[model samples]
Target: MPVNTDPKLIAGNSNIPLADAIAKRMSMHRGQAVKPIDTRVERFNDGEIFVEVFENVRGEDMFIIQSTSNPANDNLMELLIMTDALRRSSAQRITAVIPYFGYARQDRRTKARTPISAKLVANLIAEAGVERVLTMDLHAAQIQGFFDLPVDNLYASPIFALDILHHFQDMEDVMVVSPDVGGVARARELAQRIKAPLSIVDKRREKAGEVAEMTVIGNVTGKRCIIVDDICDTAGTLCKAAEVLMDAGATEVHSYITHGVLSGPAVDRITNSVMKSLVITDSIEPTAAVQQCKNIRIVPTAPMFAQAILNIAGGMSVSSLFDNETLEPIYESLYPNS
Candidate 1:
């Protein structure tokens, strides 16, 4: 069979909305409607997953859109299984478009008898016959090295920076903050982009998911603090950091987190926290609890992903998407009035 030059998108059940949004944005980019490949992902009585690709994928460029999010194990398995099926169907090329790559935090072994699960997951994807990977805002950038295939790690900083620029007219009083010392670089990038001062939250963690004490490393007094981080799991760190910033005389507190893994009482914690609002990317689908939370807002990442897909398919540079000139149109499309 002859190879189909057009890109074919297939999605697991992890984030159907985001996949559909990407397809819509891709359609706009191509000047023609591009729909996702018809596929069925179902479950057996014992919770085993079964995937079927209804369309002819032979010799076509295939991109599977799936986020290893809540129920991470299941979603990850679905991606691997789907990749196996695509490989068996003789797809010309297979790219895994993962908005949120789970098990990323386990990139290294901090303790004895620990496994570097991120590398293991990378191996799983490659062994399943994926040719490339496209993901966003990985917890650790070095995780890219774990994969032998080319991995394009996209950033949400540009999107957050533009959103901040549009919303906060008064840049003088705005301060970008890192929730912890490790995130200082991420926060500094955004601060530099928006031309705002940078600050860090010095916190000591006694154990996982718990912060003992948090100190504001810089003067947040009389400033509207914007905390930046990669993930918000239990919300303990973010909530505590916000409290510390407020105590340090911050006028208002907001957060721009790349991934909203809001698990285990996170929604309740954020709803009652002193933070003004929390802006997260739609990398992972928002839950009903997250949707009902008034202060939580989601920024669609579909436009960026769509552009990246188009570039990849055309043999164009994916890094060019980061430029303001290129991003302006995407940002504007998301917030047309701005």
Candidate 2:
């Protein structure tokens, strides 16, 4: 089914600021114009969830804005209930705009008889009556195949590339480094954008939560290295990669990730690492620790997401979202040389 524009934009408590920013980018006025529906998520005495859609949405196309980032379970439950509420209220169609899809890393069964949680989440969304899905920078691209419904997996590459070009004064000397072989495609895509050389970190995982840094695959010595990854969960991979790069004679190390799931000592690791800076998108809410981390910086993905929603609404090609010139003009118009 084709996505609809002008759908009633409903927001849960997950990431209201990002939703609001998307609203502004679409030129929708505050309050009634976009018909923002608020999902009142509450908890019962028995530890159950209760959700109420405060507005009527009968026969209207709906898009629920929520991110299953940190506190993934609570946010995921909120999205499920919102979808159910909209479906029950007789909405025409529903799309879950999940900017940071949690549990995406569990795309495969790594151990014996282990369940694929990513596939399970996909099933849950489909069962909730979501007609489609919109997400960005999933941990694994194959996860998209897990969804029965049509899924539009957006990219933060355009946004991240633009930021790198702007901030890194010596772009010509920058080398894009992938933290692992699994992310070679992602790294190459961005490296091509910035016209930088590409390298990979030949890392070995000794055990869960422990990484053994082996070697650098390409020549990164005496060049500024930028490690790229889809998500930064524990910062273990990135920090280890940075250390290896520095040891191999990299002049400086910087990093960019699409989603920053800074769990358990991630902030401390990055804060004390040899990295010059860590740039992440606002796909997930940053904790106070993330904010306090001196090396961390946030780049907004609101404009890109807003343009995508507007393009879908206007019967335009959302693939155009990846066109740098198409979106760059508007982004500059809004961000002003940013």
Candidate 3:
């Protein structure tokens, strides 16, 4: 079937700048048929949320852009209520475009009685009247299986890979490092794109909040190591990995993560760590903590996501966007000096 034209965009309060940029990329001016469903998201004295979509959406094809980031529950419920509102208003379809999917790390239960919160979130979205989902760089890939509806799990590696090649083009010795065994596949995929070697950090979890980096699995002694991962929450794993790599004789330690959900003292940890730079995408809105950190840098993912939204609306293959040979050139143009 052909992709439908005249797709309607509906945005939540999570990241309006990103939503606006995506709308712009789709060749739509800021205020057109596509505009934010004007409403106020508030809470009562008892701490419950209230949302109301002001505009009419009857028989429209709606795409809701929201990031389940900080105050994840609120942003999540906002999406749910927005979907239900659209459904009740007779919107033909509702697509939830969540750039930074929160609760994704809890895709599986490691303990005896723990809950798989990611699956539960998926159920919540489905039950909330979402017809499909569009997200990027989930913490766990298997979470896609949790969604019964059509799920488009996009990648940020192409964006990161191009950035690295442009910034470190002259540097001959380069290696992509995975902070833990779990991230080896993602790191390896990026490494293959840049023709760089791959290294793994062997980490031992002493407790819930602490990590001890043991050894480097691959040769990274003389190379500039770039640690790659999906998210940097507390920066515990990244800081530990950078220290371990530096101690292992690596020349430099850099990091590129998709979602910079830098909570708590993550920015402080990165600022005080051995890493020379920590590059991340704007999948999650940058908080004041990120703005205050000198070591943190943001790579705009607006174009990639914008193109994805356009393709999806036009009934084109969204996956083919990453397969382009011009990816490096396009991304490098965005960050010339890197």
Best by lDDT: 1
Q: Which stretches of candidate 1 lie over 4 Å from their true place?
A: 1-5, 336-338
| 299: Cα error in model 1, Å | 0.4
Q: Which ten residues in a row have the lowest lDDT in candidate 3?
A: 27-36
Give lDDT tens digits, candidate 3, residues 1-338. Answer: 33356677878888888888787766542245455557666678987777777777776667899999998998998899888888988887789999999999888878899999999999999999998899999898899999999889889988887788778976579999998898999999998888888889988887776885478898888889999999888998889889889989999999999999899989989999999999998888898779778989998887777667666776777788576464554454576654
With candidate 1 superimposed using the best TM-score fit, by how many Å does residue 287's alpha carbon deviate from the native? 0.5
The TM-score values for the models, in the order shown, are 0.98, 0.94, 0.93
Clashing pairs in 3: 3-315
Q: Model 1 over residues 142-242: C-alpha lDDT tens digits? A: 99999998999999999998898888877899999999888888999999999999999999989888889888898999999999999999998999899
Q: Write down the lDDT of every candidate, Cα atoms only.
A: 0.93, 0.85, 0.84
Q: Is candidate 2 or candidate 3 better by TM-score?
A: 2
Rank the models by lDDT, top first: 1, 2, 3
> Which model is ahead, 1 or 2, in terms of lDDT?
1
